[model samples]
Target: MKKIFIITGEYSGDMHAGRVAEILKQKNPDIEIEGIGGENLKKARAKIYCDHSKMSGFGFSIKMALDHIALEKKVADYLLNSYKPDLVLLIDYGTFNLRVAKRLKGSGIKVFHYIPPQVWASRKWRIKGIKKYVDEVLCIFPFEIEMYQKEGINVHYCGHPLIKQLPEKADREQFFAKHGLDTTRPLVSIFPGSRTIELRFLANTFIKSAKQLQKKHPEIQFCISHAPNLSDDIFDKYINGTDFKVIKGENQALLSISDSLILASGTVALEAALYQIPMIIGYKGPWILYLAYLLVRCIKKVSLPNIITGEDIVPELIQAKFNTENICYETEKNLYNKEYRIGFIKALGMVKEKLSDKYSAEEVANEIIKAL
Candidate 1:
């Protein structure tokens, strides 16, 4: 039996890696897959080396950072001495996976990177590390191929996994009734973020923004696309007295029916574009961290829809600009301005077209099999 090792760090990365695992298994029944990932990969039947739930965070403290470094080293030692897999697949989670790549360097083990590090986003210097360590890179975006190839890295544009994963739209009336939402009013969805750190910084702001928008347009109904990993108390702390309905595990269905959305910048922005939902993207962090990020960020725009289209198709309010007033203004524009909303939605079609219709997971699996 052929053995393959995969590594991913966050929820989105785990989800993408799981799809690839499913495709790989279907193509070759004798293959054995193991990985350091989350529940999604576990469900796909990849033997878990380490559950990523304990591994995810942004800007870790001294002790946490040291612990993660130790953990990465432990996994690397295990893979090198015991597992000795035929192929190593590294998905996102740039910092840890890049270190793993370094450890496996020149071991004659094929290292295939799915959704490789966003070196183009920032830290362009990491491309050198990627080129030196990874054997091949499977990219999701069309433009990423040229960027990686320019640095002489072998790369393939596998389109986006979300293209296949986007769920069908639910019946509007039934969806509203089932969620106990107001059917008569225009609906606005809020996606604060999936991480606890993100919620800590932005959830109260989202609630305040929603309340402000509701006061102005009393006929507008507010709801939250809550992440399943987070506790209900996290949301209740901010929305206890508010009328916002928290919808769990139904992001696509909610996006399909929303009139507009107030969201944090992440993969959900791309999903909003896929659903053609008019939205305002917002992000906030500690002042010191925001300052440091602004200093290093190479791109002007943060939202995925805007980055994909290479234009500001949707409004982004980040750092100091991410206030309740700005959120309300943008949401109001998306909800009330027909021309603005229509134009934005039309631009999203071009963004969707750029993603193409290729089955990303299957294509990635084919590459892995050929490499093996």
Candidate 2:
């Protein structure tokens, strides 16, 4: 059996890698695996060299520079000399993955990039880096394939991994009963983010917005879904005096019961769409990090739902737009207005159509088998 080394950066990447690898394994059970990942991939039986928590953060690479460099060199050297897999699969961990890609450029191991970096957004030059290193790039977005192809990279549009995870019409009663939530009252869910920096920037703002809503309508219930990467103390600190409950890592369940959501932009927004919940997406990167957004013109949209459907299905309040007042305003619109709810659900249905029914893991597994 040939060995395949899988590399992932954070929780979402780990989750994506785990699903893809599982599907690939099902298709070819004889292939052996090894590399860096987290709990999900570990459960999938990938021999993880390192867990992703040491490198999880938004913005500057300088924040985790020393540790990032250490891990990068460690993982890269390991793949190059230790396991020496037949193929090296790089998931989205822009800085480190690129470094690993560079080191393995001429090592004879076929470099397959599963989730390409956001070069279209900030580091277009990274395509130059990718072209020099990666042999085949599998992209989730159809647009990405064209972009990388334009840059002379062998790219494939594999479709997004999220489309396969769709649940049957959400069982609201069962969900509520399981979580012990009241169905009669309006449910509002808050997701600050999985990172500590995101919690610092948006947690207070979310709490303030929730408090304002609670003041006006005591009948409303505010629920927070804590990203497992972050601690419960983070949310507790901000919501100490307020009447709110934090549901650790139960983002999906919390969103299912929600009439509306206040969440950080990215994967969670996509999840919200699947649940058919009216949502307001918000994000805040440091000032210097925010400048990176302009440097990378490739990122057209921040919300996953919008990117997948090629249109804004829900309001994305990024950077300056991500404030207490803005969140409250959008929440009010989505919750009280009949038109907003109707329009959002209609857009969500279209997003669902754009995605493949076959699981992402299954599709990605097929790609790996064919590549080998």
C-alpha TM-scores of all predictions:
0.96, 0.92
| Top candidate by lDDT | 1
Write model 1 residue lDDT over 260-295, tens digit each, in one string: 888989998998899888989999998888888777
Task: Note the Cα lDDT for every prediction shown.
Answer: 0.87, 0.79
Give lDDT: candidate 2, residue 104: 85
- TM-score of candidate 1 to 2 decimals: 0.96
Error of 1 at 16 (Å): 1.2
* Residue pairs in candidate 2 whose N, alpha carbon or C atoms collide under 3 angstroms: 120-298, 121-296, 121-299, 122-296
lDDT of 2 by residue, 1-372 (tens): 888988887888888888877776777788898767888898887777767776675345675677677777887788788888899888887678888888888899888888788776666788898888889888876668788878888987777777766454457788777777788888888888877778778888888989998787787788888787776676566556665777876667677768899998777887788777889988887888788667767766878788778887788888888787888888888888898788887788777777656555666677788878
lDDT of 1: 0.87
